[model samples]
Target: MSCQEPEFVTAEDVGGFDDLWSSYGFYNEGCFEKGAPLVLNDQQLFSDFAFMDDMHFDSISSAISVAAETDQPASNSELLQLDEKSTPPLPSKTSELLSKYQFKFNARSGEKPNESIERGGSKLSTEDFMRIAASFFIQLSTHKDCNPFMLNNQFGLSFSGLSSAEIMNVELAILLFSAAEKVSQQRFDHGTNLIKECYKLCSKTGNSVQRVVYYFADALQERIHGGKGTVVKAQEVMKALLSNHPVHLATFRSLPLEQIMQFTSVQTILDNLGSAKKIHLIDLSIKHGLQWTILMQALSNSSSVDYVKISAVGTSEEEITSTGKRLTSFAEILKLPFVFKPVIVSDIKELKEDMFKIEETETIALYSSMDMNTMIIKPDRLENVMKVIRNLRPQIVTVVDVEAKHNSRSFINRFTEALFYFSAFFDCLENCMRGDERVRMIVEEDFFSPGISSIVAAEGSERVIRQVGIDVWRLFFARYGLVEAELNQWSVYQASLLVKHFACGESYSFEVNGKALLVGWKGTPLHFISAWKFQ
Candidate 1:
């Protein structure tokens, strides 16, 4: 057929190689000279629909049809954003609540209160400190035994606990710096006014914290303006800011709650199966069993499947204990005879040998919510993981993780949800009053950085140190010729939506004013299937 001639293709078609080529350059360059509508081939009709219903895209089928009629395929990049217009309106209740908090706290003028938290007064009473300390100690003491499920329910550091004045000092400075960087239009000068104000309030001997803040704001301004000597300036500033600081890089070594949430997000995308066998969850870091606790609960409640065995892997022993305990408990609750094994390797070469120890079976479902993202960031680590999973060839590898896009570029609908929900949780903690109102104070004053609040509000856990979930899953499946599974479960859908929401914010805007496409802070739910059948 002539390039311009109408041709038939399956409506179920993801752009074919030819369409991809044309979409990239040829078609846009006038390769298709005809105005005639393409009679695209269609896939088998849905069982109930006699017509070729299965061939169609559900939400954006109309847009796709237009592209097809023009002898050009819709670009994948644009297709990803098609849903931008379809975001459901946010609930009025949610909007009002967020607005109230935003006005109350974000609008506050002058320096934030003496949140400097000194010991004395009923506001800073010993009883209050003891309560906070007790909760903090429990988390530290149970680090090896605490999983996300347990910790999530308790009052502990959602990301990292802040108790020592030294840790808090460094953390607060960083938070201010990051916040200043984000809000500043010039990237460098936005927080200068604030810093200068802080200086005036400082003690005469030159408070290092205030100095560090001033230096950081100066360095940030330099970096944004493309001024010379940015790196050296930043380094110097960092040295000064962190110098003599109590908490070292070692204190910030492990992943945060935000990271762990990515792994659990995979569960939200899973098909609510009534029954199944072994399930394999993969990830680079699995400390304190946070993600596993969530997974165990998901499995126990899954309507579609029942799991008898679970194979989980972590980068180290320190990350495995809590996950292991949670998994064991989950199995016990369900009264299912289960074996939870941790895949470990002292060396990369050993991983291959140890990986083979798991039985190759058809009934297994491989769930790697955290693995894929870490692999994307560190492809080398994924090579062995991909090979092992490919060999075992589990029924499904459901990936749940944070999308790699920065918060600014995330899908708007999910982003809104995330902003609203996260703000609610954060406000709950930050708005803690002194005395009986400690919780609000903790949220507001304790975790000031977007990073910390972000982790605590949504993703606080060990899940943060790995690769992006989507990229890792895509590559892993493609390497083994696996197909992207359909999401057939509601929980999986919720998980996806939750993640999308987590990444969004008020800065997001749609093409129109009132029709704002607020982020839902959730994502599309998915169900996965295998191209090849299990044994």
Candidate 2:
């Protein structure tokens, strides 16, 4: 080993081999001779027929969707658009109706309004805060403790009592509870009054008891005023992938989400491959290169293959370069000759055959872990790309996609679906991510917020995070002349082990849908992993 370089044993020393091959030249010059476009082999049919299924953004609508919960029906008139005409006057009987509830406000029993509250208005007491908070929490689909917590709903938000700040929290919570159309609309009207009052009291900053006034203020502008809070920089969105900013770390490290599902992605490619002299894997989008490292170690443990080459493609040259270096280090640790190819693509139009260099008599596999479909933003481009892929004739192509109806063209439909989808995601975090409030906030603010913001606020090319379900993806692949291939049963068994290993056995479940596996929390599907071969 060189003085500066890290030293490691040969693959043979660890895996019962007598010799290890040296790193060959990066590209296979011999196979550059282009072959005529290969025809889709129809003889490779696996399943006869199968069914299928289906992120956040920013915008005026996105703003409301993010800060304002949509438990009520939303409409152009009903939605609080600040620039629009003044919101309707608060219902005269609203306070009276609310007083009928079992609130028992701690307004000194015999005193008048001014004696109870300095401002001479009927301000709610600390107990009132808990009652209000409980109301909205009960309507939540996420939050594991929603029901159990509701059993003892008498908890206080602030002992002193209500302020515009706490009122803002209550208003926000009301929006969060997804109620029926009529109820949601009613809540929107009531919440609008709270928004107005909160802003009116904004000048008296001291009265804003909740320490986080700006958060509430921002949401007010976004939700009630139809304000698109802030335009998120594209780089910031991508940076979230690496940021240890609580959100990314929680998502990047945890179980049933990033780590375990990532394990499933790697195993999908490794399972049931016959002996070959060399292995070539092409990743359409290598955000972290995590799966490759896990795969490299697993490959090192086996004596089946000799050379491994990884061609990583992404929008960032830096990420691709970084991933290459990391993969190279792992390969060296196993004393294996590994090649990492970095392909930078600024647009889907940049995708071409030249990005992939075929090697003579080598086994090739393609992976699009939560990638590919995202790049197919248009029909013509998607078709052309599929044509390009069809020409590669890879041994297999593995795809993992988010399972939600989040890609609809209609903004209303997309926004509505996002609420339900992310609610479940948050619930997963709450039940599964105990003692990690900071992580949850990060995931919600930085990760979920930005994503939701993009989906809600952005349009056209800015909306790159659009995702569709696996069933739709099956049809998409079929157009390229591909069929779903069953992941080996061993890989299926590994799925259960991954859950148990994560110590989240009770929190997650897996289903083998034909050859595809749907791994999700409780009964809700989060992601699907399936492999494909020529149809």
Using TM-score, give the best candidate's number: 2
Model 2: runs farther than 4 Å from truth? 1-250, 301-304, 376-384, 409-412, 456-464
Q: What is the TM-score of candidate 2?
A: 0.59
Local accuracy of candidate 1 as per-residue lDDT tens digits, 70-121: 4444443322321322332322221232233334433446525333333221
Which numbered prediction scores highest in lDDT against the true structure?
2
Clashes counted in candidate 2 amount to 24
- lDDT by residue for model 2 over 317-403, one digit each (tens)? 775787688789989999777889877777656688777778778788888765554443444445445656677878888878786
Error of 1 at 350 (Å): 7.0
Stretches of candidate 1 off by over 4 Å are 1-307, 322-326, 329-334, 346-356, 369-376, 407-482, 492-535
Model 1: lDDT equals: 0.33
